[model samples]
Target: MRTHGWRGQPPSDADEARARILTATRTRLSEAGTTSTSEVAELIGVTRQTVYRYFPTTGDLLNAAAADAVIGLEAQLIKHVVEHLARTGGDAADAAVEIVAYVYEHLRDDPALNRLMAPGRISSTVAGLTTPSAIALGRDWLAHFPVDWEAVGLVGEAQAEFVEHLLRTLQSFVVDPGEPARSGAELRAYLQRWLAPALRR
Candidate 1:
């Protein structure tokens, strides 16, 4: 919260400006379940119009911030996957199931992520996930998974399709997640039962 605006200095470039806005948006989400372009503008000592220039819509702002939060989550998932396999002696499908389950949990539990869909933003959140940037992010994340996607006949374009499929599934869970919402173990089992068999070619 610099009063002088961006620590009393303008962003070095457009990239820096966008980065600052995203950082501000994420901070606002951490502090409050929701944030607005004005709020981010105020935080960064910029105009809402400036923020809007970079993120034309609220969805764009929230999604960019959430994506930033997700970058650090990859390391957490890496560890969680290793431990889950060690404990459950799971296979590739199982690992994939755990990954999905873990992500659902992360989305459910992480304030920054969960809050992106705050109140009136549900439609925007859904819209955000479908954006090309969001799809690319999901695809890149899955591409780094340790699971043997080949065994599931998910090589080449099929792999890309599967990644999109997985992203959509996660999007469904995020949007609805059912009436009572399943537990992590229950989620894992659910994915294992349905998603696993589908993957086995």
Candidate 2:
């Protein structure tokens, strides 16, 4: 195999290379506001091609690096959703809107989560959010809801599909966010009008 100035000796195997790329990516994200493929490559003494070989794209690299941060964001989101459910008697659709609105209203206050909501390359960002791990994490977040998903007709595949839908909704809010992003009462009302119907069906 060939190498591209990756320290004294290049990674001995593909696994090490991928790990190094992830490490480099996390480091780059910390030092710079964004994680660029070329920056990760240079930081780790490898060529951009090497980084791409492991990560496929900058979005993939960024998503990989931010996976841990995702969990933290989920924790806060889950807490807020659960609390909302407790206060409001846990309607499934309303809980869904709560998750979306909570992030919209508060994502900026938390630096880590604020950064995560910034959106990325459409393909990779969607791919990243829909990965098995991400999906499972979504389910985990939902599982904490005080409502009975089964009683609401969201069991088995229905529940899993709901998780995916929620992810897409979150993506849209953070990405395009309409001409002006909706939050607080306006956002909640908008979600109740449009998003809640989908959940009820």
Candidate 3:
């Protein structure tokens, strides 16, 4: 791996260096509720210039770190959806409700995610959720849910469309929660009543 001139031994590869920076950023964010590129560089024992090469702006770095932090949450979400489907005997609509509710609650409760979604921090968060990458991530996430896409006659573009719709629903709820925010059973029931018919259709 090419060494970017370092004050000490550099990461073995570009991927490793990027990972280190993201990890440091997460650590700082967790401890201080925010992080800067310079802080991440210092934490990783690299210079700000090195960090900037990987993430041109602090927004870029925070977005990357937020994405990294969400990796585990995504796995947990997939697992929850799979288990919900199993329990529902492969009821796609019901599983969708459960999955949506889980995501809503998880985002509301997760400190790291909440921090990213806080007041002024929402622009980057919104960008991250609405971008093509977010759509691709949604596609990949839905594909892992063990749902019977073929049985539901939701294949190809239809499946992709469903994922995008679901992502948009979740994004809307997160960004501008409706009056009298729904929670627990109310949220699940609301989603089921509204979303189930769509899935069935």
Candidate 4:
């Protein structure tokens, strides 16, 4: 449940500078749609050359921001899921509910995520987290389950399909909160009813 941030190993001056640059980029993007390295440099009171030194181009800046944001999002998901599972006996269905609830909460409270999910604010960071790549990463994170999937007979293709469906459902709920078809607990119960049989395979 460890949450990783830009904080670690006593960031060096260069690291601090890079973080400042990234932070500036995020701010500019959040505030204004188009952001240039010059604008970011001006905001941070640094030379454009310094900005370019850290990020050679706008694409590089965008890519780095996306990567960092996705990493942080993944960490947040891991921490929330771990804490929820601990309280719910680490059942997969319970974990699914916790994950959906956590995502909903974060989407509501996190300014960055709110922006990402907001209409027309979709950026590379948004795409990176919502893409198939991110979904796979989430499933891979769950694959490190403490529960014995094999013991429950839910191994192989059944487990894979269940994970895919679980992730998709959570994602769909995130995008359409207003029309949420079911509560997380209800969804969990439904999953257990169908998924337990597959696991017993």
Candidate 5:
């Protein structure tokens, strides 16, 4: 028989509570990195023990915070792409370019996110953000993308892989600014050149 491993499914109530607490904690951390447990508990309308029940340690809270931020970020990207596509005659390739440009323009100035994912104390966030929860967020985001993946010569899995790689590559740029510098427009151009061929499939 196969072992369950240590990955037992959480009860639904506990899972919902954990998700709520993590959501609050992420907002606190993104807005203010050195958040207190008391503050987060208060924000979530829960007692400290309730918070502890979900995340037993400050490190755990921080880990959840990172994952939460990634979810939020991906949601925003998906929203933008959806809106853009609707307004622009439903062109997926155009939406893709806009999405990449949006990331290039906004990612650098996002302070809380920068500290959370940068090569500093919170690089652990990267691992958390790349987890299944975060990956699902990305998949959901791209699923609504206005592109015809199959017509573009990419199957569903390959399309998701392409968007995932693009996001991760852009994340690296956000985390490591000194690696190279370019204007937002220039970076957008670069991504278009690199991604366009694969997108065309």
Candidate 6:
């Protein structure tokens, strides 16, 4: 019967409880660079049992938080690309390079994303991106861009392939970053030269 999930105020429903837990998780991650069910429960004035009822494990909690964070961040990235292309008069290829570079740079520095994408946790990250949910998210986001996929002969299954390729490339860079890491202008230039051409097709 214990309902309070935050301080003295209880969430109105299960959905609200889950939201509060996620919010607490994000806050804890920002402050401590990590979080635990116990810490989240303490922050929310809930029992560890309550947290476990919602998220069975720390990984589950982290994955959910990371997914939420990525959705927001990706939207922002898309917005940035749209605005940048509009101002600069860049084509779809330019947008592709920009998007890849932006994600590569930001993902490296994103603490929550880094936690979800840690070495042993890569399969989880891969599955998240390759699953139907991820594909739908990617497709929806890309559809908003000014890119003329049809003109480039990148419609239907080709479009899906392009999205998956972009994600896989980003994941590769995030995980290994290669023997000689590229950064700053160098990385941008590399993505422009390589990734841009593929998108143009």
lDDT of 4 by residue, 1-201 (tens): 111232333235777777877887878777875578888877877667767777898768766665566567667888777776777676655565556566656555544445555556544433454466665666687765455555555566665665666556556556555555556566556556754444443
lDDT of 2 by residue, 87-145 (tens): 87768899989887885565444433445556444446545666777778778777877
Ten contiguous residues minimizing lDDT sum, candidate 1: 1-10
- Over 4 Å off, model 3: 1-10, 45-50, 70-73, 87-90, 105-137
lDDT string, candidate 3, 128-183, tens digits? 77677777887788778777777887788787787777877788888877788876
> What is the lDDT for 196 in model 2?
92
C-alpha lDDT of all candidate models, in order? 0.76, 0.73, 0.78, 0.62, 0.64, 0.81
lDDT, model 6: 0.81
Best by TM-score: 6
Pairs of residues clashing in candidate 6:
none
Candidate 4 displacement at residue 101 in angstroms = 2.5
Highest lDDT scorer? 6
What's the residue-level lDDT of 138 in candidate 2? 76
Name the better of 5 and 6 by TM-score: 6
- TM-score of candidate 6 against the unseen true structure: 0.82
TM-score of each: 0.64, 0.60, 0.70, 0.59, 0.63, 0.82
**lDDT (0-100) at residue 169 of candidate 3?**
79
Off by over 4 Å in 1: 1-67
How do the candidates rank by TM-score, highest first? Answer: 6, 3, 1, 5, 2, 4
RMSD vs true structure, all candidates: 4.8, 6.5, 4.1, 7.3, 8.1, 2.7
Rank list by lDDT: 6, 3, 1, 2, 5, 4
lDDT of 4: 0.62
Backbone clashes in model 1: 0
**Winner by TM-score between candidate 6 and candidate 1:** 6
Output candidate 6 Cα RMSD. 2.7
